[model samples]
Target: MEQERLVLEVDVRVAQPRAPRRGGVELDPIDRDLEYTGSLLTLLDPLGLLGGVTVVALSLTHGAFFLALKTTGTIREDARRLGTTLGAVTAVLAVVTLGWLGLLTGSAWSWATTVVAAVALLAAVAANARGREGWAFTGTAVTAAATVATYFLALFPDVMPTTLDGGRSLTIANASSSPMTLQIMTWAAAVFTPIVLLYTGYTYYAFRRRIGTQHIPEPVAVG
Candidate 1:
């Protein structure tokens, strides 16, 4: 929504394309210089609203699956049951939204990723039904990854598409920074990513045990 408000809703096209793409950006017709002009909408349209709802539903379903996988006793049981229900709802919404995107974009890669997403979601639901929380979690994770891939594939060269005018869309070629900046960013990621990953792994390893109500201390009596 923010992207729509800030970039997508308005026409940000230049008369000519940018010069000298040193960062290997695949230039398309949508690749133009930024010069914002036109109005912005206070809210998204009906289809955009539906997309937002689908996104929220997906997040809720993902959370339910995570809870089912992590906790124990009543929480786990409740989460497992809820995850199944939410999964069904998410699947329906996902089909509608993703199908619309596939039709709109008409990209073969997007269609392939959409199929993967559907299969992963179904697998997650099935795993949850059989009380295989670990597999269920993995399935949901894969579903999420596939869904994101589908969206990106659908987007293709365009990073931010314009509903106002197709030609006004922001392409990766227009959005990319200079080669020097990208190289610095690459080195920065290489240096810092492993440290972040190590910290995350250590945190998970330290608190890996599953907890239930039994682990919670009783409230102290107030005098």
Candidate 2:
């Protein structure tokens, strides 16, 4: 009888639900939270790409204007040729970098892209150092445009992918924010964007003149 009773007690104890342990560290919860945060952070990169693209476009347009202002009726044909060649080379390098990033995700591609971009960038630096101002400016403009395009192309899928699941995912995540918060952010941007544009325009206009040995003022005497 005691043996049967002991067996019954063991069975009852085995069938009872016990409270989960508190301290051993579960991986699933941590992994899930990390994944959620990572997705949120990924959205920022696309916005950053868009911002960079806008800046590059502005710089290129302003730079062309600056060049025209500085060299009006004075630029040699050779300088124009050099500038065009430099721009073309830099643009090609930029396109290669963009394609490399989009198609290749491995270490070899990464290294190759880095080496090519570095070479092109170094060439531009050397040209500028040699007083090839037009070439330098053209290279800068092309490089910036390429970089912006590459980043945008990579990040666009994260922000707004073609896949239905991706769109739904972003929608859910984005909609989690409060309506009042969204409204405030929208209003703030509306108020500040024009101010930013005006300030940027003013800065470009103020610095439009070219730096030349003759134009540089002598250092003021100091006590």
Candidate 3:
């Protein structure tokens, strides 16, 4: 009876769940919650507005040039029409984005400005479709420049509040990385950016003329 009791006790102890081991420190649930909240805040941050503006501008310029090339030949009439349609759509999007920014800033003339910009974009697309590269480039350039300017204007006001608090200041200041990181980034830019720019320029120069059926290489026959 004593031996059976001892075996039972050992089995019970072996089956028991172990407690979690303690670390040096444990985060409070509130702190963990706040960390998650901070991550969400960063994802929705408006401080990276300039990055968005740069993407839009670069997209506009590259899209216009590529469309112009694709639409230059009579054999691809549908392609030309599609290009024009895409251009018009992008232009309208640009106008809407501009108006959205203006509205956020409490501009009374937002609607009017948006309408005018949209109309100008439509006209520009039509002109570009009719082989007016200059008009198309001008419209794209204007829209891109305006978008960039508006982004900066909106961003500055948001960052510059009347009263400054430690939390607010920290949020704004820590939004960007350290100065040494930025300096290294600048050094990388100096090293690689010009090379990329030169190669891009060379590609543009090499394919400057309008593409035609001749440019499409003949397909090889499979044995």
Candidate 4:
């Protein structure tokens, strides 16, 4: 199941590798280059940081999420206790990421992007406080999506830029693969992704109910 989902995700990304441009409104070299530089040092990296941080965030997010779902009414081994610990850690990461984002982008920030990120952080915290499982997970998803979208949108053409020599920076216009390749991947994704999604959804529905200690039979003693 995880493998199928990953395959679908790879297809999705392959179909659309180049991120959003800065609405095609070119910034002067000073502004354009500085924005990228500031953002980079502030912990947003194209080839590395965002993806790496996102994977960590997603793992922490999943830890909290499943803990919320499967732990309700499960007192034998209080999953919420572990879930709370995970939430605390994820919250710390989220706060740090949010702070990193604000340090650079807040002043030069787009209100839409910044606001969503802020709201996401707050939502996660609040949902956890109230034990709202769905909302807590939703907040994590929003936080990841909004942060990624904001960074990519701001990044625009440049795929990766360096302070040493801005001349060599990679950009979407130059870095993208062939259009035909993307189209082929798009068709492939369209064929397989829905099936994977359906199966995943069905499994979740099948296991929708909460579990308790009684669900686990006692262990037999060994001879």
Scored by lDDT, the top model is 1
- How would the candidate models be sorted by lDDT, starting from the highest? 1, 4, 3, 2
Ranking by TM-score: 1, 4, 3, 2
Error of 3 at 82 (Å): 2.1
Q: Residues 1-223, candidate 3, lDDT per residue (tens digit)?
A: 9999999999997885322111211111112112221223333334235336535644655365455654456644654565576675576456545655565552434444445555656666777688676676566556555555555555453342222112232134644679999899999999999999999999978876667777789999999
Q: Write the per-residue lDDT of candidate 1 for residues 65-107, one digit (tens) a residue.
A: 7787778999999999999999999899889888877776749
Residue runs of model 1 more than 4 Å from their true location after superposition: 1-33, 36-38, 162-168, 221-223
Tens digits of per-residue lDDT, candidate 4, 1-223, equal 9999999999997784232223231222222333442332334333245446645855676566666666546551354455456656665655555455454434455346756865875677567666776677777678777777666655565555433333345678656879998899999999999999999999989988877766888999999
For model 2, how does the per-residue alpha-carbon lDDT over 56-107 read when each residue is reduced to its tens digit? Answer: 5435533543354355334433344444454445445445545445553224
Q: Stretches of candidate 3 above 4 Å error?
A: 1-65, 106-123, 157-172
**How displaced is residue 88 in candidate 2, in Å?**
7.6
RMSD (Cα, Å) for all candidates, in order, is 9.6, 13.9, 12.5, 14.6
Clashes of each: 0, 0, 0, 0
For model 1 the TM-score comes to 0.78
Q: Which pairs clash in model 1?
A: none
- Give the local distance difference test score of model 2: 0.48
Instruction: Pick the TM-score winner.
Output: 1
